[model samples]
Target: MHRLIAALVFLFCATVRVFPHADKVEDRLVMHFATGGHPPSNGRWEDINHRHLAEVKGTPTLTNIGPAVALQFNGYTDHMLVPIKPEDLPVTAISLAAWVIVNETMADGGIISYAQDNGPQEKGFALGFDERSFTFSLATEKADDGDGKLTRIRANTPLTAGKWHYVVGTYDGETMKLFVNGREEATSKEQGGKILYPAKGRFTIGAYIDDNEFHAMDGALYEAKVYGRAMVATEIQAAARQNRALLDHESSINKELKFVVAPYLQFGTRDSMTIMCETSAEAQMLVEYAERQPLVSRTRSEEARLINTVTLSGLKPHTQYFYRVTCTDKNGNVARSDILTLQTAPGPETPWAFGIIGDTQRNPEVTKRATDGIFALRPNMTIHCGDVVDDGFAKHQWVSDLFAPSATLFSHVPLFPVIGNHEKNAHWYYDYFHLPKPEYYYTFTYGNAQFFMIDSNKDLSPGSEQYRWLEAELRKSKATWKFTCHHHPCFSSDENDYGDRWKGKAPEGFRSGDENAQRLVELYEKYRVDVAFAGHIHSYERAWPILQMQVNQKNGVRYIVSGGGGGGLEQAAPQRAWFTVHVQRGHHYCYAAVHDRTIQFKAYDLEGRLFDTFELTKGR
Candidate 1:
């Protein structure tokens, strides 16, 4: 009897070990494709689990990466397939993860999918690309009253093409989640119950199962993995961190020429300013400055870094200084920037002249001409109302279209720029320009005028941070004149006011029929703002002192749209708005001369023609 009990106990222990609880099971499949062994022409990809090997279709090449290998897909007809039985796929919980490097933008493509076909009844899951966003979907038989439906979650921010990114999709029975770069981007509820998978369906990588759909990936893929159970947030984050290390390793392989971007100015003030520049290699920076043409004072930064910035203080207000920057790269290459001049802000009660320009995208030559015209006016400083480049992400645009064309003007005069939609709130804009605190929206005092630069791309309704800050700044301001600059005119008469191609639908933050616009107008009236300047219509428009959308020249505010700074021109509406006093279609800019309580304004076209002129007088 004792021997029989021992035998039964041993058998029970063996059964428990073989059939653990479903939640306790840690079943996973990892595929490091083409990393070590090359697949045959039949396209069989071996998996680490040894249970299923993928079948390759079309033509895919194996590229050597050090001692390992990586698979390349032509994005058209190439794909890797793995036949999976219904029982092999996870039903209650699952996770799919991959590291991908997209070659270019595609209309539509699948990265990984288990669906049988593109039909509505196809039962499985798919992680794919739709336009610029990454999408994840799950098909279930019970989703839509037994008719079979798909539950999809998309990443909040679009993924940039031609870059390496880590993506993961998981379903924890009750919730569906999508993560990008270790951060949870999107989530969906009501995804409980088991997932549906067709009995004969095959798991596909880099292409959909439907041959006629042409939804194939065009990129390089590495380190693909799948798990039967949904991975917790910490596990997914750890996978992303590991992928980042691999990306860093790949980036460190190439050593190219340095000095991609030239030296530029930032944080200009009455007595201090900063000079910033970028280099491809580590470098030391030196700057020489003096009041005269031949610089005498020298400042040097000993620390070596790719991005270099140095501040110069103890400067005299209302004085002009000449400076030059020199950098010594790690490889002993020395480069010197052009000698430039900087003019400090004038003291209180001093007369000052400043220029305004806007919408200079896609017209570098025209922008150069306008800057020359503004320089001819000899303004002490400049205010740009936004849209500085056609594409803020394109480095060449900033160099050829903006910096190179306006180098002389930028070096001599401090520029206060408003955030434009075209800039896309890119980090490069923030890195290049140094504005007041909370740079997107801030106020600065120059002479007897207080200039406020705001980000019209953001929410500015009553309780918004920007709106509250603006009200406080206006209430506390003691300057004799107040001026605000931003993209999107507060009172435009151009076709842009009618929306894109006259759809009659305005942009969210734009001035026409927008809550932000109405709130801003009320603030302007209450504060007795001297003038508000804006761009984005690609034309010139000036409104009479307007209050509550009507002419109130006594104490109301003037709204001007001077978007004609080199962008393609747009015509004013056939029937102008009631407040529109003058409007013109041309590439132009505005020049303002402020003296105590009076401001003389002039608008000029590219040909140096003075199209509009006005004067503002406050406090008698």
Candidate 2:
């Protein structure tokens, strides 16, 4: 009985000790939207002091700040409603705070949009954010139509997603201020004068609400607090120091790491393959697999890391195996992943299938459709020709736009990617994927075919590093089928990207097929490369077999421009060029089946429409 009573006492003490601001000036704090809660779904957060209570709606996921866990809105229909009697509303001087992580930028996202109307009188003000920047808005009056004419001041720092922030906005009768983390970012003296409160009011969190519809927030809010009196700079700064401690605690939630990017396969050769994943914390990773019996392997890095890669070798060629990844943080807390599978490459005589996509950027929804379609095709492997993300430097897009859509496909199949112009040769790309030395250009052989991945963003002309490497590699490749892929099309029926030949106008900068990449045409012809693939035009085009820039069906190379991965669809040249055979503008992915001396390829749009098909045979 004594031990249970002691535990209860500790729990009571912990519940009340939520924030530094509240502990410092308990009487001045009107409410903290999330005072004490377990991984909350939806319920009431009543002020312990009996001042106010917030009604939660929909389900907000749990998010942690420091040691405190708060709610994260889904940006669609999640919100919290706080009713404030006239006596509780801050009328003249007010301060608002939100510990947040914003996922998307929006025009009217309300970290807190406040307004309370009582009969003919309005009694509240709103606190909202611009995402890229935070804004503090105050108004002395509202229009008769019931809209506030707020005086706004903005902070400079962009509130990027996937990180924590301590944002504060305040208004004292003479000045308005906005602070991020703990330092002052902006100030304004526009609204000034006395603000009024009516007989009753309301303070809302997670959304902007009034007589107008609610503008939901696309972020996680660790806490939202209201102070009856505007806090001075020194007090706010001191409170920020305490916030820093809380954020430090946020480093690892619940004492364990989370899977940021789930386990996926990479670099699969006949006898070896790599298993990779990323976690939120620097943690040691262990991978277990089974072919006929269970086997274990540790990550390559001796030190802890957010990215963990495990290579499994000495396996049978063309064999399948099931595997799972486990992450263990320093505290010994563990996270385990579901079991998945992978297949090793087969010998040259075995048949194989693969999927190809290009320019998968900016549109994850469409990308998801394409990826799902590809997954349905059950290719043994996948290739992203280039432009994997809208900006290769923006690491978040790599997860959101590329990896998310990859879904079940990547879990089972390996991916080989080239560097596109959009990648900008960012370090994140290199860190995320374990590729060969000089990652920008490399070659891989699977079954009977060999793929040459080029970095079109670099100089591929004669004498350039990629040019010399490709010439040497192509000459040495004795595979039955040889294919080359890059970002810029060697032959595309693209209109403006190439010169606007229909109007007889030279392109401002770009041309249809890259002149530099086109230089490889001579090399491809000489080496008898079967097919050249690229994506930059955001459409699908296949050129007639050509040699020496002229049609040569007997022994010439074919060019395919399959840019329609996820970017907005683009158009082909107004009229077919001399080398054009088929051109279709749409979002798409391609799948191919290969066997000795024969290749069967097909293209499909997002809705699973089989738009085109063709076959290539050696020594036909």
Candidate 3:
């Protein structure tokens, strides 16, 4: 009886093909990382049961999200390498599945890959993202290169940030498929034959690795599994269902996502204009612009990065163009801006108008109201007299206090700005604005008028570099009109700028305007500058054309202080100074339209009340 029973049991075990205590799901997995490497194998990630190990390349930390533990890549320099043999990867069919959460948009980075080369074209398989486009990549005999000629496939889904996702990519010998959240999202049939692969390649996780390790990913990665055979829709769905339990807690973080900075125009000229916007997280940027037709062009970052600054070229001079920006995170979340329009700079002889404002610091509501007035006028461009933000170092203020409030005006009008005292002379100003070399002090001529934008925060004394540049610029300019803009005033009559006369005539030390700024009066006198615009004090003051401390309407430089853009109101002296012709204390913006040698200058308050108007005309 014992002999018969033992013989029967042995036969049953042999036919059943049973050995380990793994579940059905685990039985099919050729290699698996259960806890970013459970049973923590020193500094390596050991497969759940298989001896296939991955050498941790960079410093990957551990994070416990909800009920699961994951490995975190720093995005800039973290990855893993599992040495893989040709036989280890199936030649006919294979599937790769992972639980991933991307921290930012990987403009060009890999999630997991085992490829032959690193160039645009290679011979292998990879799952990655580039320029807002994310997909599964597999190479075959029919493919021309590794990446471009029908070598990659992506779903129309957008990748979002701050959420865990289960993704699977597979090849079933005839078709390539991508599954997200257990559902098939994308499929292709170009790679029909056996997959072409590298003999001594390594399976890279959380980064792009082919010839070498290049693009590293940021965020956490959970169990990643590999199967030698193609995983059917049911198997992928089952696997995704199992992984979904651990992500129930982290699913609410995306409910209140912050948007990127509003789109703004910059570096605008006759033939080009740069449309710029910044994302809260790293994102791939795509800018589309059109003149008369649906002219579409795509742009990708040289690498996955944070800022998108694209210059639209081949634009027609004095022509209007419509543009918009779209940003995509690696997880397929997309954000797009509204379409806006801007006209390129007209020729010097063209009749055009530009608006000017100053001191729009720390007052959002007033700033918005003041800028709306400017936008309605539909000027060719807008000029900021400086102090765009109260604290230049606090980077967020640039978005809230400046960009957000003036979004409407800036979307359509390119802004030319001068640095103000409130800007703190920080590098952020230079990074935000795209201008000529040494952007702080530069010159650009538009529509018969030449503008010299000066950085009064820097030294403007007689022997300073700015002095020499101004001398050379003004001496050679032959435009119909010449204008100079600096933050500090060359002439002012604010209550205390000249002197704090609490109740009397005031003390010494204080002058009519900034002494350093006043020193440039000779240049205005010598060159016969049309207007000297400034914005230090928070009030509007239009001085009579002054030549040598006297009002000379014929050939003197007219100085105007349109400092009422937004700020606490200030008053003129108890007794008005000589340079002050007209003064107003309110939030306002100024507009100037130049036709031939004549300019019509008008200033209006937030109520749309024209408080000041003047005309300056020159002879032929």
Candidate 4:
């Protein structure tokens, strides 16, 4: 009897040692991606918790971390997808955790997801990056139509590219929480009963399984784990704490490089230019520049700050210059940027081309595509009619949504922007762009054209300061061509009209129409402006030369609404207005060439298809 008891005790001890956390282990799915070999040769990646192996597609490489393994995705077609089963679906509460090292910031891509098959009626959860922010989303079917409606919670801080980050998303039946770097960043109240799963659901990594809209991640993911039960904050923190040494090593390497936003050209003119960028910390900034040769001239900022601006003066007109920026942090860690080139504005009557695009606020991918199209045209300069970002106060939106995507374009071509309503007159807009004095409403002359960038969000009454200043500038301008760019439109047939009425009664003081539009239009007409560009509506509309609401092409001023610059498209009214000559609903931009006394305008959609073209000759 004693010998039997000893055998039983030994068996119980062995079982306890094998299943350390048996109670929690049964409700979790852990995938280490440590398939001992590379892809194509290594058929599948097994989930250590369950035997549910995921089929690897495309050429996914492998990397070693000490004795462990991690998968490297190419951001194109690399993905690991598992067929969904009854055991894979979460019933009530769920948590997803992953360690990722993003190589580049994408528009939208999933890190880990489980989604339904139907295109629009998909129901599931995904942890990914919406543009640049870490986001956790839950999609539920509508009670009426069964269409999917998404509820999302995004982290306040953006994840740094080329760095490892620990991310966790948890839903406890009432509230959804998103944690980044082991700290809670955002939360949302989602009181859904049970997580919904469609008939053809799938669990995928590196991309959305069912939707083609979301892009694949361009990064490396390690140790992806999912729990059927809600994971508490302590558990998530503990998991992240295990990698504290790894994160600290990364942080030390990052500190060696102090630059955050690279040096980009801004506020360029014939004899002057501004080089602006941001560093990771307070650093002394300097720019060494010369004309098409080794650096000979240097300009240094007097103060040490994160945001560095160095203006180079005495630059030759219509000349190209090579330059490089260097920054040194407090720790004596020096960072040097790549060599960049910049060309000053052309001399008067030199025949230059400039591009116009606006409302590039919400969508970064569309904005990048449109900017690339414009860049291919090789414009001397670019003009943005405001709404540079969806939320002006949100600094992340400016960096990720606007600045980062347009960095390449704006680095070469100087951008003169107007203030849109979305900016809310925030100081961030003023701080970012190096505009003329009274940055909101200012005029700049490029080549033979004098461009007026107005703040349409503020009051533009006849007696207002902006109105008076605009009148004075117009009266004094001696340039051959005069163009005005603002946010709100005096005439728009699109559904986004501020007052709903497209053709309203003209106010007494201003002849254009009621509201601020009337006063602004009167100034444009009185000043004999060649063409006025406005972009509040999210569609392209070009009006005939209208003077006092009448189409008089001779002395009237033309209005072109080029608001379709990456923002969501808006549909125009069915019945076209008398002044509306051409209208198209799509993402588009305008390219204008000025030579002698004539200006040629061509509107091209995102695909480079020319939809509208017109020429204006100044009656000299």
Model 3 misplacement above 4 A: 1-258, 299-301, 330-332, 505-510
Instruction: Give one digit per residue, the lDDT tens place, for model 2 in 63-122.
Output: 333344446565655778877665656777888988776655666567775664334444
- Per-candidate Cα lDDT values, in order, are 0.72, 0.75, 0.77, 0.75
Off-target runs (Cα >4 Å) in candidate 1 are 1-262, 305-307, 499-515
Compared to the true structure, candidate 1 yields what TM-score? 0.56
The full ranking of all candidates by TM-score, starting with the best, is 3, 2, 4, 1
On the 0 to 100 scale, the lDDT of residue 350 in model 1 is 86
The top-ranked prediction according to lDDT is 3
lDDT comparing candidate 1 with the true structure:
0.72
Better of 1 and 4 by lDDT: 4
Candidate 1 per-residue lDDT over residues 274-297, each given as its tens digit? 777667677788787889743557
Query: Which residue pairs of candidate 4 clash?
Result: none
Better of 3 and 4 by TM-score: 3
Prediction 4 TM-score vs. true: 0.58
Error of 1 at 475 (Å): 1.0
The per-candidate count of clashes, in order, stands at 1, 4, 12, 0
Runs of candidate 4 with Cα error greater than 4 angstroms are: 1-255, 496-514
Best candidate (score: TM-score) = 3
Local error of candidate 2 at residue 43 (angstroms): 49
For model 3, what is the alpha-carbon lDDT of residue 458? 82
